[model samples]
Target chain A: MAAANENITADAIEATEFMELSRKYRVTGVPKTIVNETIEIMGGLPEKMFVRQALEMPEE
Target chain B: MGLLSPQDEATLKNHLSGITIPVQLVLFTQAFGGSESGDVAKQILNEVASLNDKITVVEKNFVLDTEDKAKYKIDKAPAIVILSDGTDTRMRMYGAPTGYEFVGLVEAIIVAGTAVIDLDPETMKWLQAVDKPTHIQVFSTPT
Candidate 1:
C-alpha cells in the first residue's frame, strides 16, 4: 500500500521485538494491523477485504 | 550459518532476477544494549543482498546515527527501511526477517526493485486514491 501511494507509509513491526508498542496497540494476536492510528484489523483478510479495511472504505 | 538453504537461494535469485531498479536496504542496529535479533537481522539482510547485485545493504548505528534514525523514523533496535532507486518506499521492517517475516521482506524488496504491485485493478485504484497521510503499522510474531 505504501509503495502504491506516497501518502501512505507501512511498517511491519515484530510484536516480540517491540513489546512496548505491541502492548500499547493491544496486539494480543499476530498479524494485527493498525491504520492511521484508528482502524484496527485483528487478523489477515483476503486482499480486497484487507485493502478495504485498511483504506477505511465503505462496504459494498 | 546461513539460514536459507542452497535450493532457497537459487529460487530467491530467480525471483529477484527481474529487478531493473536498484533497491537499497538501510538497516539500523545498536551495537550495545540491543537484542541478539539485531545481529540476526543483519545476517539475514546480508544473505539477501548476496543473492542480487542490484540489492545493497547499508548499515547505520541506531544510537549514534541520530540523523539517519530520525530520517527513517526508526524507533527500534533493528529496522529495515526499503528504498527503490534511492527513494523511500515508505516500507519498514522491524526485527529479524526470519520465518514468515522473511517472505514479507522478499515481497517488499520485489516491490521496491520491480515497480510491480500484484494488487487487483480496483485495489490499485483505491490505493492511488489515498490522499491523506496513512500510517500503517502491522504487528506480527516470527512464528
Candidate 2:
C-alpha cells in the first residue's frame, strides 16, 4: 500500500523487538496491524478484506 | 559463516534475475547499546545483496548518523529503508529480517528492484485514490 501511494509510509515492526510500541498499541498477538494509530486489525485477513479495513472502506 | 546455503543462493539469484533497476537497502544499526538483532539484520541484508548484482546494502550508524536517521524517520536501532533506483519506496522493515520476515524482505526487494507492485487491480485503485497521509505499522513476531 505504501508503494502504491507516495503519501503512505508502511513500517513492519517486530513485536518482540519493539516492546514499548507493541504495548502502546495493545498488540496482544502476532500479526496485529495498526493503521494511522487507530484502525486495529487483530489477525491476517484476506488481501482484499485487509486492504479495505486498513483503508477504512465500506464493505461491499 | 554465511546464512544462505549454496542451493538457496542459486535459487535467490534466479529469483532476482528479473531486476533491471538498482535497489538500495539503507540499513541503520546502532553499534552500542543496541540489540544483537542489529547484527543479525546486517548479516541477512549482506547475504541477500550477495545474490543480486543490482542490489546493494548501504549501512548507517543509528547513533552517529543523526541526519540520515531523521531523513529516513527511523527512531529505532535497526531499520531498513528500501529505495528503488534512488527513489523512496516508503517501505520499511524494523528488527532482524529472519524467519518469516525474510520472505517479506525478499518480496519488498523484488517490488523495489522491479518497480512493480503485485497488488490486485482493485486494491491498487483504492490505494492510488488515497490523497491523505497514511501511516501503516504492522507488528509481527519472528515465529
Candidate 3:
C-alpha cells in the first residue's frame, strides 16, 4: 500500500524489540496492524480486507 | 560468517536479480545506549546487499545525524529507510529484520527496486486513491 501511494507511510516494527510501542498499541499477538492509531487489526487478513480496513473503506 | 546460509544466498540472489533500479537501504543506529539488534540489523542488511549490485546499505547515526533522522522521521534506533533511486519509498522497518520481518524486507526491496507492486488491481485502486497522510504501523515479533 505504501509503495503504491505516496500519501501512505508504512512501518514494520519488531514487536519484541520495541516493547513500549507494542504495549502502547496493546499488541499481544504477531502481525498486529495499527492504522492511523485508530484502526486496529489483530491478525493478518486477506489483502483486500486488510487494505479496506487500513483505508477505513466501506465493504462492498 | 554471513547470516544467510549458502542456499539462502543463492535463492535470494535469484529473487533480487530482477531489480532494474538502485535500492538504497538507509539504516539508522545509535552506537551507544543501543541494543545488540543494531549490529544484527547491519549484518543482515550487508548480507542481503552483497547478493545484488543494485542494492546498497548506507549507515547513519541516529543521534549524530539529526538532519537525516528528522528527514526520515526516525524516532527509534535500528530503523531502516528504503529508498528507490534516491527517492523515499515511505517504507520503514524498525528493529532487526529477521525471521518473518526478513521476508517483508525482501518484498519491500523488490517493490522499491522494480517499481512493481503485486497487490490486487482493486487494492491498487484504493491505495492510489488515498489522498491523506496515512501512517501504518505493523507490529510483529521476529519469530
Candidate with top DockQ is: 3
How well does candidate 3 match the true structure, expressed as C-alpha RMSD? 0.5
**RMSD values, in order shown:** 0.8, 0.8, 0.5
lDDT of 3 by residue, B70-92 (tens): 99999998999999999999999
- lDDT (tens digit, per residue) of candidate 1 on B28-133: 9999998999899999999999999999999999999999999888888799999999999999999998888999999999999999999999999999999999
Cα error, candidate 3, residue B10 (Å): 0.3
At residue B41, candidate 2 shows an lDDT of 95
Better of 2 and 3 by DockQ: 3
Q: Which ten residues in a row have the lowest lDDT in candidate 2 chain B?
A: B97-106
DockQ of 3: 0.96
A1-60: candidate 3 lDDT, tens digit per residue: 898999999999999999999989999898999999999998999999899899999878
Model 2 residue runs over 4 Å out of place are none
TM-score of 1: 0.98
Per-residue lDDT of A58 in model 1: 92
Candidate 2: clashing residue pairs, number: 0
Clashing pairs in 1: none
**Candidate 1 Cα RMSD (Å):** 0.8
Q: Which parts of model 1 are misplaced by more than 4 Å?
A: none
Listed for every candidate in order, the interface RMSD values in angstroms are 0.6, 0.6, 0.5
Q: DockQ rank, highest first?
A: 3, 1, 2
By lDDT, the candidates rank as 3, 1, 2
